[model samples]
Target: MKNNRLYAQFSTGYRAPQTTELFRLQAGQTIAELDAENINSIELGLRGQVESLFYDVTLFSMHKDNFIFQDTNRQNISNGETSHRGIELAINYQWQYFYVAANGTFAKHRYDTNLTLSRINIQDNEIDTAPEHIGSVQLGLRSDLGEFVELEWVHQGNCYINPENSSEYSGHNLLNLRTGIRLSERLDIGIRVSNLTDEDYAERDDFGFGSYRYFVGEPRTVYATVQYQY
Candidate 1:
């Protein structure tokens, strides 16, 4: 227990209706007449160090009332209840000239009560656009001369695209590389390459108006930067 710490937290949140949520017209309705959202959350965490390796892990749960969401008709409405629960982890290790760091999250966002979104019954359905798994890991090498190189991999899990849970977006994984070195105390140069594999994927996906839409992700690209500090 000497090298570890445990902690817990409780929090509450409130959010008033946004301008669009309050005034946006839907079908024959003129005003939203929406109520504010209330949220309650609890979290527990543990962090510690084992020699040169460090780790932190956390678990969290949250409940919301009057949760607002846009329905199939593009009208904002409030639901009776929603719940979110998740776990997060982060770890890092460094030895001499090499180091590795990683972090990840797994969560579920769901409707807690039966609700109707434009004639569709949604109960215990995952929230649209809310991915259940997301994570990134990085490996790097560095020297005393300020030279370093890092490679990272990022991942996203699939999720529903509609409140009805009838459609989903199959997630994506990406690779990125970065390298840099100090030319002098005040001068530095670096280069970065994103989407290294040029994998075809969508950064975002949605379903609306009886159609599926995608925002395409960028292709493999390289860029450089030079920095001078006064």
Candidate 2:
């Protein structure tokens, strides 16, 4: 308990209907009828340091009333209720010339009450495109000469692609590499390679109108940057 801390929090949130949701007319309608969204949340957390290692963890739950969303017809509507719950973790460690850090979230986003959308019943169903797992880890090394390099791995877990929960998108993983050096007292140089493995995956996926659609992720790419302080 010497280097540890525990905390708890409760919060509330509110969001008024957006102009598009209020002003956009649906077929044969002058204006869409929508209500503002309100949410209540609770969270518990712990953080501490053990020697050279530091870590933090949290658990959270949130509930919302009148959750606003667009139906398959692209018309704005409000769901009666929705719930979100999750756990998150972060850790870091360092020793001499090397260091590592990682963070992640595991969560569920669900409709809490039975509702009809686009002629479909969605009750206690996971929200479409809401991945349950997402996280990244990074390892790096540095020297007293102001040079450093890092390698990172990113991950996304699978999720439903449609409100029906019948279609899913198998998630993806990617690797990235970056290095930088202080070129001079006023300058710095850096290079980065994203999607290092050139993996093929979709940045986004959707199922609609009897079809599955995808927005492809970027291929491996390299970037260079030089910064000068004025």
Candidate 3:
């Protein structure tokens, strides 16, 4: 089409502190009435198609003020400022009944103002709970018999667990499979297997109260679902 296009956008935004941030009660903790966070963002994006292949990509940047974060003491606090940027890409190709698709994001979140946690200056450090990379890929077949099957791979990059960047949670890769069939004009059924390799990984980790802890990810599991339309 002659109208295929690329675009760029700029915007400013802000977020008021959430209820949890304003009123979470716990022993040894004090809640503060916090200011809303603000940000200025810019984005560039493209969408186009060539033959049987289609793709989209976006690049974006954000300058944030009063970024809400949890400190080493597990208290919700506003950080001075931060710079966030990322690239996101997605592509899909199809030839007849067979197709493949992938999408991913690579990002960076860094402190723009110096922070003192545990008596350490953490200016320009990677923020906790921020993964540098995350993505997924899939291959699948679609048939006229009202059925489809797909295999997928998912990934997450490592990230720090503390504002000081002293603790880490390693990255992980996982495999999954899904298949579905139409049982009738009004019914469908499906089956899924997640973490096909039964890989061991930590979903999250943190240091609190002078101790380090983690939540383990789920192991290999299978499940089924049925859907009926009225």
| lDDT (10s digit) by residue, model 2, range 161-194 | 9888988998999999999999898999999999
Error of 1 at 188 (Å): 0.7
TM-score of each: 0.94, 0.94, 0.88
RMSD per prediction, one decimal? 1.5, 1.6, 2.5
Sorted by TM-score, highest first, which candidate order results? Answer: 1, 2, 3
Estimate candidate 2's alpha-carbon lDDT, on a 0 to 1 scale: 0.91
Model 1 residue 214 lDDT?
88
Error of 2 at 135 (Å): 0.2
Identify the runs in model 1 with alpha carbons over 4 angstroms from their true place: none
Candidate 3 lDDT over 1-230, as tens digits, reads: 64346989999999999998888845667766578999999999998888888999999999999877665566777867999899999999999999999999999999888755556888889988789999999999999976999999999999988878988787899999999999899999999999999999878877767777778989999999999999
Q: Per-residue alpha-carbon lDDT of model 1 for 1-230, expressed as tens digits?
A: 89999999999989999987888678866678788999999999999999999999999999999988776567778866999999999999999999999999999999897766647668889988899999999999999988999999999999998878888888999999999989999999999999999988888887767788888999999999999999
* C-alpha root-mean-square deviation, candidate 1: 1.5
Report the number of clashing residue pairs per model. Answer: 0, 0, 0
RMSD of 2: 1.6
